[model samples]
Target: MSFRLNPFKVMRAVGIVAIVVYGVVLVTGYKKSKVTTTESVTKDMKIRNKDFYKSKDYKNNLTLPNQVVENNNEAVAKELEQTKPAETVDLQKDSDTSKQQTDSKVADKNKKKEEQVKLEMQKQAQQKLAEQKQQEKSKIAAKQAELKKQQQLEAARKEQAAAQARAEAARQQAREEENKKAREEAAKRARENAKKHQGSKKYIQVASVTTEASARGIAKKLGGNFYYKKTTVNGKTAYVVMSNMTDNPNTLKAMENQAKRAGSGYMIRSVGK
Candidate 1:
């Protein structure tokens, strides 16, 4: 077999070796740094732990008197439990006898004290009830007094109302009587005035005319004395007719009716007040 030199193979091998060497160097450096950091942290932690243990707080925590007492009691109880059974039974019987006597005496004292407390509470409750009843009596008396006063006031008001009603009735009756007297006096005066004017002269106007001939014609037709009342018509002289007849209401009404039947514009006129 002939040996051949391959440049590519050599180059490839060199590259692989370089890669492995770089990896080894990286791993070694990482391990050394990690170890140094770990050592520094451990040293600091040791120093902190030592300082803490030497502090007053650590001494106080370690010196627990209650824990030591509890341990001593536990050890003593264990030892007592390990004693001979015959001796334990005799000791237990004696202790039980003494405990029962003491319990009986304590129970008697508690019962007497409870009885006294109950009596005291009952006395206080009685006193409170009596005080409440007295207060109620006072309230009732005050209410009665108020009610009586109100009733008296109401009675007075009713009496005042009755007096006012009576006064009003009397005043109304007096006003009515005065009005009746006034009406009677007015009637008397009216009758006297009627008697005084019973003969007052009166006349009726027959008709109006422009000339004497027209006046005479109307007077002849109506059977009355005719006259002229000076008046003006279109700024010229005119005359109004008159009738010389008695002031009888019936005769005036008849004349008015006759004039109305003859013409449309005829009217009756009263003369002299």
Candidate 2:
């Protein structure tokens, strides 16, 4: 198919261009009309010289350019003054909206700061509690250690006391044994001294020694043996003595008579008779 441009679209574009050119021409070159130039002296535009002479009026045509310019300036100043207040009102409304937004942001920030401070305080309180607990635990541990040390010291003291008592008891036992030995030795020595004078004999009447010198002297004394010897009767000593002989009445009488006449002590002994 062949390309075709629509007539209505070309016409519409040409009309929009004509309207734009017309607006440019009107804005760039615009001047006041004759009516506006003459209206500067009167409130409305005056008629020309023909109408003035026909009406028999002396025209107020000596109008000043300064007055016209001044009036126009006053109108422009008033319009500008009126428009400025409206713009300022709109600006004040916009500034109020912006200030409200800024205040809202500040309030939100302060609220967040308060919340953060509360959280920080909570954390600090938790830390303080933890520290207190730790200190308590340390105190408890120290007290337990002190108690254990005291217990150990007490046990050591008791052990030392018991050991000393045991040593004292052993020393006392040793002293008792020494006293017993001494007593036994003294008794043995006394027995030996009492028997020292005895003679050797078998079957003595007693263990003590008899009188010295003769049989006449022997009848007046107790009889015994000195240095006696026998294996069975005693372990290493024996005893011998004199006694009466019996059953020879005539011979015994003669001997008794002889002893009585002499006043000599005679001992009676056993013989083979």
Clashes of each: 0, 21
Weakest ten-residue segment in model 2 by summed lDDT: 201-210
Best by TM-score: 2
lDDT against true structure, model 1: 0.64
Report lDDT (Cα) of residue 262, candidate 2. Answer: 39
lDDT of 2 by residue, 1-273 (tens): 223344456556655655565454433322222333344434332246655644422333234366876786688677666652211124344445555655565557556655766676677777778988999999999999999999999999999999989888888888888888887888878767745744332221222222233332433443222122222344433333333443445544554444344343433332342
TM-score of each: 0.30, 0.39
Task: List, residue by residue over 117-190, the lDDT tens digit for candidate 1.
Answer: 56666766677778789889999999999999999999999999999999999999999899888888888899
Candidate 2 lDDT score relative to the true structure: 0.51
